[model samples]
Target: MSGVPMSGAPAQPDPYAAPDPYAQPDPYGAPMSAPGGQPMSPGVASAPPYGQPMAGAPGQPGYPQDPYAQQQQWAGPVIPPTQGGGSKAWIWGALAGVVVVALMVGVVLYVTGGDDETPVADSSATPSEEVDPSTEPSEEAPDTELVTDPATGLSFAPMPEPWRDSTANYGVIGFYEVTGQVLDVLTFEDGSGWIATFVVGEINPSQLGSSSMTTDDAINALADLVDGAHYSKPPDFTEPLDGLERNEVEVNPLTVGSYSGSAMSYHLSWDDDSIEETGESIALGVLDMGDGRTAGFFLSLPDSVPDEHLDQMLEALDSLTFV
Candidate 1:
């Protein structure tokens, strides 16, 4: 009021403030908000306020190091499948089956291979084609002279013709006797306890035992061939026999094939050796064959003959024949 009766200076507005229409109310350059506003992702780490830096910021270099650099890991290789072992086993089994079948076929071929056209060697010896034994039915009695024995109620006969009397061939049927080195044939007259002996031939050895068995069977087949038979295996012999008195001798299971033998000997008398000065006068035998058939030589002589001449009996036996 003193200096001229009115005001001299006037007041001015702030320079950074917005004008009335674009004005913001917050003090820290933030837009004006409600009382409690929060950030969108509150857990994420925020930038440093003014001067501090982040721990592993990509743009920075030469800071702390990472510990897991040289560690190793593994992965396996792939394999292709082969043929099944079971299939291989089946193939082998099939081959074996074929081999077995082939063997069986071979056996069949062998079995059926025999010749059907081969002819028999001797037709006379065949049983079905042979002469009948029961009734010889011939007027000619061959060379044998049949005689009836009063003591045994038996028949004694001589060998048929052609053979005569063999004094030489002593292998099969001979007339020779052996005393050490010397061999002679036994001879006898019609007088005394002598009986006649019939003679025949040297048959095949295979047929020998069978012939013996067959003849034995036939002889024993008759009820009166012998009263009884006594089976004996004397220790002195290498074999055994079934002594059927005057009927026959049975040496079964004899091994004509084996190197060894079961040999035996025996004597038979009808209670009459009165004129005898030596041992018992009877029928003595050495051996035949086995195979159920054999060759036999027999003689009826006085008991006065010495034992040393037994080989002579065998030698005489070598002269045996069945007419």
Candidate 2:
């Protein structure tokens, strides 16, 4: 009864009791104090919990406010606004360029003299002198005598002197008579035995036993007569000369006194027992006188005469004209 009789005495602790499951465990393996407990060390503050603000931070009560926090918040950089929706500096630059160009144009106009002056002519020259036409000398023409033939109604200027009409003495020297009416005969003797004769005539076809003949036919017939030695000797010869020679005849168209005709020119030479050897140049022509009428002419010149005399004879023939 001694061990079972402990009812009123204080219960002693149980050495083998299980611990309480609802109690908080100590984190640092030390016993935890109750709320309002004392710190483990003096004058050492505790750090805040993991994510809370501490005592002296920016919004809290103890420390001075942050120096950068009260300033204005920085959004970005600041830029000045433009006037007229563009830069004023560009407008000023353009105005300066225009002023410089105006100054350059003014300088160019001042350097060149500009187009405004009128031109004047020089006046120191002399005038030309006048001429007098009345004092000039006049030219005089050569002296000539124009003679008209009565039978053929033709006019001409004969040689100036020592040439005369010898028609009345026609057959006195034994020249062959032409087959026509003898109109005129001009004869010249140069005082040195040289002589020439020009004969003019109207052709008579009846004398040649023909009713009609052209001027060409008459000239051809005359040429054939001369060529056949019908008129072999010169005018002062009584009979036919020995050894007569005729050269080839040159026939040419001729103009005489406004009438067209033909002429035959040839040279004849002869050796006569009564005289020395001699030769003559002869030209014969036939002209149509119009209206069934015709004319003929003959010229004979000794080779001893100067050629100028022959030229004069031809000039006189050129001067012949119908009256």
Candidate 3:
């Protein structure tokens, strides 16, 4: 019981046992002996306790020496850590691929020269088709009834209804003392005795009974004729009629059709006579018909006549159109 070992306990060593030939040779050389006179295997060396250095390790006394320890440290290139994800070489490869694609796109744009863009049109350029002035529609004048003067061949629009050409019944020769040929006579049918007379004659001073050197003088002479005939009693009159009181005369420039002229307007009153106190309104116009010929118009209206009649007569004068 003293020498036999129990189960799970370490076996005791035999002093007379022989060494096995197949065992591995010791690495540190021959075997060593303990202080108690026991033989020890060379493969088994005494190791120091935990937290202490081994007795026979390097840098310690009696440590075994290595022949090639002093030649050099490793001195190789450093390798970066490949711990997290993909390596840095793969990232650099991807960046180079992107730069190459960008350069290729730039080259394509330069070669095509941006041909997809549209060109701007010039605003000041003329159109291809020209418009013909004759083909375009023109504004037409208003429609009106027109009458032509037999003497001057000039045309005009006569006054509206109830007014007629009373030339046959009216005495055109003795109407005015001017030495000219009478052209036309117009009057109202209402027997108001109002009349409009037109005349054409030479610009001779002796014939018009004035210093008619210019057309303006002729116009003034025509105005003077109306003033002499109606504004005062004539020296040749047989009946003793009251001379009409005259208002201030107004002279203004007038344009009728293509003729330019002057017009004289005034009002006359006969207070003592059988005629109404609000007597009459008179207007006279003289236009230079050119080529030494002048045309004259005289309109006389009693105050009893409607104002519309006067307006109609004036409109008739404006409607003159020279042939």
Q: Per-residue CA lDDT of candidate 2, range 1-323, in tens?
A: 01111112124432212233322222212211111111111000111110111222111111111232111100000011233342222222222232223323432443443454675544665644656767665766876755554556544567644555433322101011221111111111321112355555554332222325544555555544333322222332223446765564555554553565655666665555533454555566565666544555655554444445655565555555555
lDDT of 3: 0.34
- In terms of lDDT, the best-performing candidate is 2
lDDT, candidate 1, at 231:
14
| lDDT, each prediction | 0.22, 0.36, 0.34
Between the candidate structures 1 and 2, which one is better when assessed by lDDT? 2
lDDT score, candidate 2, position 135: 66
RMSD for each of the candidates:
63.5, 81.6, 70.5
For model 1, residues 188-249, the per-residue Cα lDDT tens digits are 13211111122222122121212223332322221111111111112211111233233223
Provide the TM-score for each candidate, comma-separated.
0.21, 0.44, 0.42
Q: State which candidate, 1 or 2, has the greater TM-score.
A: 2
Clashes found in each candidate (C-alpha, N, C closer than 3 A): 25, 0, 0
